[model samples]
Each structure stands twice: as structure tokens, then as C-alpha cells.
Target: MTDAPVRTDPSERMCPSTPKANATVFLGMITPAGRVAYVTPPLAAEVALAGLPDPTEATESRYRLAGPCVTSSCGFWTGDHCGLGERLVASYQETGVPDEAALPRCAIRRTCRWYAEQGPAACPACSHVVTDAR
Candidate 1:
């Protein structure tokens, strides 16, 4: 089979917990509860440096750029599948977390790998993972 092209088109949406860099397009914020809160007029740069009236440091492990497409640069990818998504699903099952919850109102759900691979079941667990919640 032909290898999937390394996708780099900006995602229509992004996951908050995913590691992001300053150059990433700021589309949304992952609330403390793990729900994604989208920005109406997405910031062109990191929120911490957006020069807002009350700018706060983009805490090292807190917020990062998330978008609507898969990042081949991510270490979790294996061909067209996301290894992290698989592990997240398995972790949820091992923890006895029920996989029957309403899908989150995610801006990137349509293009999210976890959502695509694990379906609605991945949402509940997605909230629990952060770029640096440890």
C-alpha cells in the first residue's frame, strides 16, 4: 500500500492537551475540565504573547497550539494510525471507565485521530490527558 502523505494542512480544530509550539495557530483552549473552549477569532500566535491587555505566561506544560489535522511530527503516529489513541483507549478500558458518554463539543472532532479511531469513546478519556499534567 502507498504510504500516507505526511499531512501538514492546518487542522480545522485542535486538541488542547497536545504539545504545541509558539508558531502553531491558536484555535482553542482546553479547559481545566478537559473540555475544549474555542476562540472566536483565533489568535495568530501564542496567547501568552498575543499582547492582550492581561497576557499571562503560556505556562510551559499548560497550553499549546492545537489544530484540525494530524501532525506527522508527533511521536505517537504509526503510518496512518495514532498509537497514543490506541493506548488511551486501552488505558480507559483497563481503568474500568465506561465508554458510553456524549461526544464532546470539539471543533476538531471531524479530523481528530482519536475520535476517528476510537470514536465517541475517546472523548471522555481525552479530557484526562494533558500535555503535562504529571
Candidate 2:
């Protein structure tokens, strides 16, 4: 079988170093309660609306973004960076380790400016525990 595509550098992705003037899609912010608080960039809201389960339930939490930012070299970033790792850590602390393998694969994984440039090991937002996709 072919190996899953590897993303070696995030800097090569299409992430903008600055936020777009009219770009309305933002990443979702993970709350301390382990609930994803929809904020910024309307796209985040849309994803949250469609993807997130009821916050009141105790099921495994899904992945959520903290909002688009130029934290990596993306044009979507403002000066304020979305600390995905810290937020995720907090979420895990409050909620518990998520079923990382069960979580849907991020579409941006291949071209994610962060994963490409920084590598997965450096990502504070990603879970260190890996499970077989199969």
C-alpha cells in the first residue's frame, strides 16, 4: 500500500502571513471546558455548527481551530496568534485525552503551513499519542 502523504514543511503551504481584508473564516477556539467556542472567521462558525457535537454531552471532543492567524507564514494571521497547543492542552486537562485516531483527519494536514514548517512534534496543539488510522 502507498504510504500516507508526508507534509514536511508548513512554510510551503498557502498560509498567508497576514489576515485578509475581507476573509471571514476564522478558526474555532477551544474552551477550557473542552467545548469549542465558535469565534472569529465565519468559516470556523460554520465548521462548529456542522461538526461539533452538543457541548453538554460527554462523548469524545472533535478537533477545532483557534482561528486563522499568520502565526506560521499565513496571510490569515493577525498579530494575535492562536495558541492551538496551549488551548488543546488545557482542553485535554479539563476533558481528557481525545480519541485522536477517531478524530477526522485534518484536510490541511498535507499542506498545513504549521505542520509542514514546524513538524508535528513541535505542535502543542496536536496529540502526542498516535493511533493507527486503520
Candidate 3:
């Protein structure tokens, strides 16, 4: 296998789908510790056969589910800049999350656009970013 890291678009990052069919890569469902884990195609097929329900859809919790990989053409993007990343950093600062001192050890860092644009400061609030959380 090539040693080069996978490069993902900011608009295309997504949580893994349950019964994660054909998912070769996954971001773990947790806090700053979440790491992108790789799954082989055969293993993904086996998981699909097990009839697992999507955790995020099945509950009214703040946590996320491992589901299909998807993308969001966020309104925040402007001329290669990420407004959402800026907002995330701002929110952390406003709430005293102490974002600047550290960043989560994320698996998607190499491929993440926000990390590329905003640097490590965006990771602390990254986990709390759920689609339509409002």
C-alpha cells in the first residue's frame, strides 16, 4: 500500500454509516480521541450482514452514528476559506474551551480541510459539530 495519506475535501467529510458497507475508512464516534480507522471491504460486508441500526438515528442523543459518508457544501466556504472553522474557533474561545493550547489527535487531520485552513485549533470543537444540531 502507498504511504501517502488520504486527502478528503472539507465538503465531503462524513460520519460512517452503520452496517458500514464498503467503508474503507472511518472516524470514530467519540471526543477528541476519535481516530479515523481503516476497514477492509470484506469486513465491511460482514458488518452489513449483521443488521445493525444507525446509532444516531435510533436515539435522541448528542452523539453521532456510524453511517454513510456524505458531504455538505457549507455556506461557510468562501474563496478557499472556511468560515465554519473560524466560527468553531470563536465559539470555543467564547465558551472558554481553551482551544489554542491543544488539538485532538484526529485521524482525519491529514485529509481535513478545516485542519488545513484553521490549523490544530479547530479540533477541540470538531467533535461537537453534528449536522443540523440546531
Question: Candidate 3: lDDT over CA atoms?
Answer: 0.44
lDDT of each prediction vs. the true structure? 0.53, 0.36, 0.44
* lDDT of each residue in 13-78, candidate 3, tens digit only: 433222233233333443344432222221222233233364334221323333323334435556
User: Where's the lowest-lDDT run of ten residues in candidate 2?
Assistant: 15-24
Error of 2 at 51 (Å): 12
How much is the lDDT of residue 100 in candidate 1? 47
lDDT of 1 by residue, 3-74 (tens): 222224444434434544423444355577665455433454453336445445554244444544345765
Q: Estimate each model's TM-score.
A: 0.58, 0.29, 0.48
Clash count list over all predictions: 7, 21, 5
Q: All predictions: root-mean-square deviation over Cα? A: 8.4, 12.1, 7.7
lDDT of 2 by residue, 1-134 (tens): 11232323444442311122312232334356653443322243333344446533312233243223346453324445334434445554644444535442443444444444444432344533221112
Better by lDDT, candidate 2 or 1: 1
